[model samples]
Target: MRGVWYRRSAGRVQAGAVLVLAGGLLAGCATAPPRNPNNLCSIFQEKRSWYHAAMRQEAKWHIPVSVPMAMMNQESSFRANARTRRTYILWIIPWGHISTAYGYAQAKDEIWHDYQRQTGAGGSRTDYADALNFMNWYITNSRKVDGIPVTDATRQYLAYHEGWTGYRRRTYASKGWLVTVARKVGHRAQQYQQQYDACKDRLKGGWWENFWDWLF
Candidate 1:
């Protein structure tokens, strides 16, 4: 009888361990964002909070959602911890990166700090909410200072890469590569807008949405 009881207890312990492992795996799947985050639908599907955040930014800044999403895709490929390549001297020196730009929007140090202070967002660059908001703020400022249309991704991106003063001086014309890149960003924004339109209603409800609602 003692041997039978011992075996039953061991079986129960093993079952509990299996349950724990399965629970952990489910948690991981719940928390992990999608890979290859280039597609707008995939991105929103991976984390629905991003969709809400984009909507919030557009409403707050009067900028289109596609604009910031495309610009961020260009700047960081949507990498949460992206950084600029390090400079090298004589092809061997171990110099640090050219700028302090990092995270999704790749915002530089001073501008990022100014954004934080002005907006009181206080979120890190890795946070999509913060990055999108920063992009909207920058683009809105570009519209105001440089007269670049909010919908004009090319000039707005040019002014984004170049400062407002440099854009006013037509600095982007000197850089053909930047001009090409800006045009591509503009096109991507149009694509994202189309993709978002297709899948928006279906993406309305989920655990992430519930969590965000509870959070906010």
Candidate 2:
């Protein structure tokens, strides 16, 4: 009877441990990328929290919602745990990543640290809200430092990819590919703006409406 009781207790403990481990793994896993990334309205409809976060950032930073949203799509395609591709060793084995840029915005470690220090906000890069906030904050500062307008997604993306100093020095002129990519980002921003204008009314509401939606 004692041996049977001990075995039962041990089995229960093992099962509890397994459950805890599974919970931890689930917590650490990245959220799956949105299904329809091309359409800004579809993306927002699928992820309502993302719309709220983007609106909050836009309200706080005065950067247009379309600009950072387009840039983020180019950077990470809305993947929460996105990182730079790894470099290969001898064209076979995987080595270190191209840079320390990580999470939804592809923000580098040094620049991300600077953002935290300057803003006095604590947040994780893997979090969508934090990433959107960081991107808008960087764009707002870019406007201040580089004289680039908030709505000019092209120059804003150029300044974002190249540091402000690099942008000031016109380094993007040497990189034709980057220049093209920036133009693409700009085009996407325009598309997002058009789409958002059509559906923004539905997204906006008073606190009670928002609360009701949350409950449902």
Top candidate on TM-score is 2
Worst 10 residues of 2 by lDDT: 25-34
Candidate 2's error at 195, in angstroms? 0.3
Tell me the spans in candidate 1 whose CA falls farther than 4 Å from its real position: 1-36, 89-91, 95-97, 206-215
lDDT of 1 by residue, 60-160 (tens): 88888888888988998777778888778899997864888988899999999998888787888888888888889899899889888998887889998
Q: lDDT by residue for model 2 over 100-190, one digit each (tens)?
A: 9999999999999999999998999999989998999888889899999999999999999999999999999999999999999999999
Colliding residue pairs in candidate 1: none
Off by more than 4 A, model 2: 1-30, 93-97, 205-209, 212-216
